[model samples]
Target: MASVAINMDENSIRGDHIASSMIDSELHECVRQGNIDDFKSRVQTHSAENLVTPCGNTLLHVAVSYGSDKIIAYLTEECPSLITTQNSQKDTVLHLAAREGKDSYAIKSLVESNPSVLRMTNEKGNTPLHDAVIKGKKKLSIFLASTDPEVAYYNNKYGRSPLYLAVEKGNKKGILDDLLKSGASIPIKIEDGDALPKGKSPVHAAIERRDKDILVKIEKEKPELLRLSEKELGNSLHYASSIGFLEGVQFLLQKFQEGAYERDSEGNYPIHLACKSHSVDVVKEYLDKFPYPKEFLNNKGQNILHVAAENGKHRVVRYILAHQKSTLVKPLLNATDKDGNTPLHLAACYGQPLASFLLLLDNRVDRLIVNNKNSTPYDLAAEISRRAEEEYAKTDEMTAVERKQIDSKNSIPADEIKGKEADTNKIGGDYFGVVISLAILYFHACPKKSLFERFPVIKRPRPLRGEEMKSLLGNLLVAAVLVAGVTFAGAIQLPQLRDQRHELNSTSRNSSHENLLYGYLFLDLGALSTSLVAALMLLWATFNYPKFQIPAVVLSTAMVCLAIVMMFGAFFCSVKIALLGSHGGFLAVTIIVVAVMFFLYLASLVFPWIIPLSVNQILLQVVLHYYYYIYFFLFDYSKWWLTHKLYDLKTKFSCY
Candidate 1:
């Protein structure tokens, strides 16, 4: 009986140990699979909040890490005190949630379970807000701050508050407001030894963030904060401008009116700041309000214009020129910095031709002012202008000659004449005779020998030598003699011809035929003599002048060809008129033919270089010629076009 009883006791102890192992296995399986329902059921039945798993994560830590919002809710509802529970790393459930930035609902659930969870800090002494701010989780930060304002005011191990984190991350406005309202010290210095000193204030933080609105808020809420100076730097305005916060600049200027004129440790005013920033509007506004003394040099002895020109701010330079009367444009124009470079010298050195042009227009800009390297503005402009002139001169000469030809053609028709009958006859006959003589001279002097025949090339006379002078003088003397003879003969013969014609007409009624014959002879002799002398003078002029020789030859050749064609057409028409007995129609046709030939002759004489070719061929040639021209223009003029575009942008939009 005793042995049987001992057997039953041993069996009972083994059954209890087996039951405990089965329960632990079930909990492990539920945690592994993330089966929230199973885990919650196990926790509800067993209260496993304090239970440590294999890696030392509590049931709460595992729940937070898995982001199981429902598991979290169930555990918090059941336990109601696991909100401050820390895992292996000493991270509370809230700290873990904030660190992962994935458990907002879980965090809210835990917070609702216990509002004091906001004060819970992690192993690194970072509160829930610290993690939230670091992760840029504004929603989480707001939640924690709303739960308890002290959470927002809580500093991390590094002694940076939620406001510092917000400013560092450049978050939206409400986060800082909440922190400030929560008694976060507005003037509190970040305890990080590397941060600005104790009185540095949050305005420095805002300036570091470049947050204009927050800076404005801080300034308005605490105007004394604007006067608050950092340990090393003097004022917020100095730091703001040094960091190039244009909006911060405007705000600081308004808050601290005369204080904006204050220089930083580096002795740079807000104007210098604006110039360095290249903010034209900011510079203009500051210049308009308080004109800095012209002698008030910065540490570098650079006035505002020098700074502006060095930074390539032409608008600022113009503004300084227009507004400040005491500012000497000439002294500033040639003023060199430590590098010994005037504004014009710097502009040219930097390859800013437009800026250089503006500076050079100032008579004060010493054209001969040499830099440290002994280079002058004139040297630069001459180099640039010379390159430009060489490129332009190559293509301009031919265009000028072509335009001159067109103008000459438009002015007068060489063949038109108006006079008495004898004068008209003398003009036409003499013109024709001159044309023939020119053609004969060209054929004799520069004869076109057959292509198959070998001939010595004739050398043109050099103008500087005596050969050309002798020929020209000889021709001029012959022309003078011809003109004198013609004038004397015309003067004497005109009255005689008039008397002879009168006598012929008076005797026609009753006199003999001898008087009529003698009158006709006198008229013919006078006309012939006048035409011969005038023709000789014209020919002499054409033959002597090298300038007129080419055109004369071309015009004479075209006229000869036209005359031949007109004579043939007239003869054929005359024969037809005689057969058909239509003299009026023949006369009209003759006039039309003469007019068309005259126009063709004129065109050939005017533009002898233009070859008569097919229209398509000419168009293709023209297109090919202008294609390269257009390409060259587009390539070379691109800089000017870009400069114009930049000017338009600068004038139209203030930002540019």
Candidate 2:
């Protein structure tokens, strides 16, 4: 009987608790619908804290969300402590009012009731003013900013103060004015944050936007901000110059010429950054305004020309060369840096083919000058290429050896390889073994100190002279244009063929035939696109400053090769479509013919690269044993034709 009575008492308490929850839910409904009488009756029985929503939203928070003026007034008048109640996101009623309020009247009344909530930050450290500005509540933003102006200075967890938002995202100039007028200052740095402006000022933000009007206004209102510089960004001028913002560069220089003299933490001046980023206009403007500063050297002891040449800033290099008549800039053509390297030496060391080509074109540049390492530009280029080739050989040899080992292990199961015959077959198994055999045969024919040193017939790689490059690239451009024109004509006629096929037998259209048509279209389109791009790249190389000459030429070559492959594929597809309903034997014969031709063409291209690629595999083994026999084995016929044979014949016999 005692245990039964205890269970009955527990059941009764549980029933009362559920009834109280239902009543609280009903009061929340009344708050949502603005049923004032129902809310007042239900509120008489519960404490103010008990009327909160499940998400910790007080009745006042619900009222603000529903925009219920009457309930808000009643709550503020009766239970004023609910005014500061924060929800799950730590958003007070004032935060919701500022973000979702239709007008500023409710926000004004809430702030009037409790002014301290205006400065209160939510979970994201965003105050009511931040919400107002972020939500584009212009009137509310003005009121909040003017009411407690210092609140705008409080940065959110993202390190964006209200002033930064107004410049970066707010689009409203009046809001910026009000904030600035109300003592809302933009901090130069947000301490210990990883985001930008950790040391950057608001001027950096404005300059990034390229709004000259905003810059002018900031200068007028607060001139000291123009002087504030960041360690990473240097200053507003450095950021602008680095990104090649012409208008921003103009405004910053016009307003404060002294900014041009300041250097970043990396010891690079604004002009150095401008040249490195290939901002030719910015470079010209700086040189025009301040002529003497053009010769200033950076931390690397590199002048503007050295920086431009090393970075492959071809346009800037051209401009500097054009201005060589100026006494202040002429010496930069051959200026030496800390490594005793001239601009040409740095360009060659870094393998900037375009800059090196441009430097070589000028008669004033001294190519014979050597660096501290006792290497001229030509010598450095040769050495770098040789090292690169050796590295490539090592990598290829390691990969081939590793692959062979893996194949040997995986070739036969443990139970299947029980005899020596299996091991012998695995040793000379396939095409890879044949390649290795040929490589060894070739390696033994002319053993030497090294492959490169032994190859006297193969000349060192050198940059083409300017006119030579122009002529070569011009011929390539012509080939690309011809291929582009052919493919374009094919593409234009392809749709007519489809239309004719469709009209001839609409009911007999097979999905297989349609697939072939699509394949033809795809191949033709690919050929056309690659050819056009190749043409454009070659044109840019020959005509423009050729900032990316080597890459452009290499890419154009690959594109042209791909275009030829696709063109042949397209021809095969067209033949298949035209002979779709023909006899089976005839169709098979035609496809076989095309396949033979395609393979023959591919073999022509593939066979030349096979031996040279395989030689790298046996280099280490051959170089270790045969150090005395030095001779050129693989003769480079193309190199001889380009360098010696053709030129020799042209000079020796006029018509031959």
Candidate 3:
């Protein structure tokens, strides 16, 4: 309801521009102070019953505002038109009486006098029905909506019908039910000049605000609105799916079949939206509750995986790949868009390493497949990586990891990330810098007048100068010493579960833990032994064995891989179930699983080059010079290739 104010002396209100056709201030005081007898006497003498304030509100409007029924009766009896006379808001006494309170007597009297006022609209284009319904004057609104044909399809300046506005209020009052059942339009259209409210629809607003009451009212009274896209170009399901409104999604789906298969103006289905919303739960809802229509492509011919992969939504991609019905597996895995790009192509083009990893792990996806541009996914990845490198090279050379770190910092809200932006600018590049530093070490181990160095024009790593070599040697020596210390500490820290045995020589306790004590002892000793051997090799190459530069570096890499594997093995063997409680046991299991995964990843990336060249695991004819001679290194030449059959080598090691 509009704000009502009474000025006894000067009848001027803020929003209501009343007229100044006044007779006496005393008569106005009679009306304002509720002196009905005095008002009657003054009006009989002065005949100010038809007089209006500056806001065009009659004395009866003031009477209604102050709940002075006697004054309203006196004024309306003198001039019956005053009952329908409007203030600046076009509000008749009937409008105010209906809205002020449950003054049904006053409302009934006014409505019986001038039934036209029930349909009269204010300046905001709201009829008395709108005011009653919107202000929670439930009984009056239902009565007006039933009797007034003008109220059936009436739209306010906001292009909202009585039904729409009632629902938009999100009130539990039966106004929505009354108006909805009173023949009001499902979705009221605008008149020639009126504009719709900013909200897309009543149901859209309800879902956007999560107003389940309004939604339930609409769903119960009119499920048609849930599936109706009308002028909004999208239904309630699209709005809910875009934000992962799972309850809304589930309700709409269970209520109607088209709700699950609904699409927006752009031809994006609910599953496509759910995928891009980054909500695995909503995606699961679509997969489990509805038909998993793998062939249902958007207008662009992109499937759910295409949407997920392009947005870096790895979890959604994983869920879709892992959870869909088996019959649809082929289409879901290999479906291509109009551009002839599969999900893998999109993942690679966007440089999502996790998405790429997940997609490649699925054997059904053809990584060698090319897009319309005649480029494979790996080619696309390399192309994007090169472009990123060049773009970053222009502005301080930010590598991908550093770029992500910077992006994460930048992605914070502007006010929250004050001095941190400039602080990041001073930090070094990430893993790429570590790689460059390692390459520098490899260069330092070479001869001063090496063939590549003799040709100064060659862009190969130049051998370190005498002073540079001294500094490099110092850093290497420090690293080697740290490695030796850590390996020795790891060896001594190995737990002996055998000493904690229940029986003197029970094999069950011993074998129950997978010979854990022996594995720990062997792994830790191997790490310690390999570390010392590599340290010796490093010292020899840094000082006098420049002639054996390539051989020493190969031996160092081989020992490093062996030492890493053995160190993990020692850590894995030490994680006994007895030492850790249930939760801790779960955590230990998780750790080992992650370690095994990372080990496999490392093997996939480095094994092609490392296994054949490793001093600890060299093969027969060509590379027998290293592995058999080094008992100090722990690696199996026989079992190295056994794991290779598990992995299909689509490319060499450096392809990554």
Candidate 4:
């Protein structure tokens, strides 16, 4: 039995039935094969001028996709209404044309016939321009955008405009510029009907893409574009600084300083944003131009310094300290954020050792200051310093091993040492003799019975004359002894101090020669300690005898010489140990010793008069240790475990 399907009238076909024969088999095949003459002949025979494919793809869609530009032109001219017709996916002929390489002619033909086609979108809501951009067809994209400025502004399913799509495809600077010049709104954000949540404006987009040239153009033409707000009223400057666009930031600052410090909806000024961004240049420029009031607090009673320190901008903090002519340093330094963290506290918690150091350097940096959490900067520094020491220790160990390997390969043999034994001992002897002669000369040079001492017959003028001279001579003697003792200790510790005659005799006889050199170097701790004690005693003597100010000065000079000798000896010992042992450990110990010695030297230089504020030291130590231990340890362990697990999983999966 034959089944019968109802057929609508010709009038119905003209209206709704246009799709019926329009997508007939013969026409569909003809259009797909780009048989323009056959397509026209069939259209004439069936009188289905508006024929579409079964999928609603018109003759144009098939023609464009197949690069049949001539057929597309003929069809578009014959059926102008088909120019707007979309296939099942809503992709118009223009969308298809923009996607196909040779469809530029078809696209031009469609645009020329019906300019409205430029605005048509496909099933994905992609306009011809969007498709052209996605396909990186620059010429087609430019033509579409130029056809209608709004074409450049149209967004697709992803809420990304033609400009946005162009950038995503890479090297789109030229196309983006063309779009922008063709009346694309720089401040308008591409969004869905409800508007994108904190949508990125064109300026924000440009800043993110690091398109400095476009940014400059936008700034020049629409300076106020920089003032447009994004998420939470964040302006272009906020985004620019956040992304570290130095040029964009500079331009914005220059424009804003001409007065754009108006409060945003969030009550934040550009300076606040700059501080939040921790951009040293941005902060400096703003502060330098329009100095904010010292009392000026953000909506949160937080000053600029507070923002800088919180963001861990050491240079910014230093700049603020030196430039901001406000007496608010004490308050700002001690001021606590909403979280109860003072600037110093934040710096420490954030592991900003340099910022913390600078903050503490300010005498006004509140030593007794505590954060909202009641944590002091010193508390942070202590931990940081410990971790620093640990890291240095590890590095020293590695370095020491490397050095030992090198030295082992390069060092001379015992026979070679014996050959030079005479020369070495002679040098040592000469050094010792020089020390003795210098000591004797120093002793005789004392003003005991000298010309000045003989003039003490005029004692009637001062009752303390004899005592004062005695004190001076005493201070001089102490200074001389301090110098001589330190020098003698160093000379005795020299590598060539041992007698060469004994070393040569032992080597010649092939005897079980005692390593007297090693014993002298290591076991003579008594003499070294005694000399150090004598130096300290002399320093103390100079400190006590204020009346003998001149002699005290001389004694202090001796102490200086002692310190120099000690420093040199310590350095040589450290180098020797580093070269002879595991380089890593040697380096670690050397760093620690050098650090301690530096502090000691500094203390000595400033002595009873100027002591380092302990609070600052404590703060630095805490920050270093906490960050290095807790933060870095967790990060490294997690990273290592994750990598290992991933590698194992890959191996297992591959085997399977």
Best by lDDT: 2
- For residues 240-306, what per-residue lDDT tens digits would candidate 1 score against the true structure? 7656677887888878877665676566666676776656667766666665435545666666666
Error in Å for residue 335 of model 3: 2.2
Evaluated at residue 433, the lDDT of candidate 1 is 22
lDDT of 3 at 8: 34
Better of 2 and 4 by TM-score: 2
lDDT of 2 at 441: 27
Q: What digit string (tens of lDDT, one per residue) describes model 4 on residues 153-223?
A: 56566666676565454446367656656755544453334222233456667778777776676566555
Q: Could you give me the TM-score of model 2 versus the true structure?
A: 0.57
| lDDT (Cα, tens digit) per residue for candidate 3, span 1-656 | 13343353235452233333564577668777889888877677544545777677677887887777777766666778787678887888777776775464655676777787776778887777777777888777777777764364566777666666777776647677776666544444445432233324667767877777677877776666676553443777777888888888878787765765666766788788888888888888887765556756887788888888766687787777776476655677777787777887666565444455567768777767777778665445434544454555534444468787887766767545533321211221232322222222122222234433322231223455455555555555565566668768866554445545443344665475546677777877887788678778867877785556546655665676667667766766676524433356667778778877876765554454554333322122113223222321233222333433333364354478
What is the lDDT of every predicted structure here?
Answer: 0.55, 0.70, 0.63, 0.58
Query: Which scores better on TM-score, 2 or 3?
Result: 2
When summed lDDT is taken over every stretch of 10 residues in candidate 4, the lowest stretch is 424-433
Estimate, for each residue in 194-242, the C-alpha lDDT of model 2 and write its tens digit: 3334534667778778888878777887666777777767888888899
Clashing pairs in 1: none
Worst 10 residues of 1 by lDDT: 419-428
Estimate the TM-score of every prediction: 0.41, 0.57, 0.51, 0.48
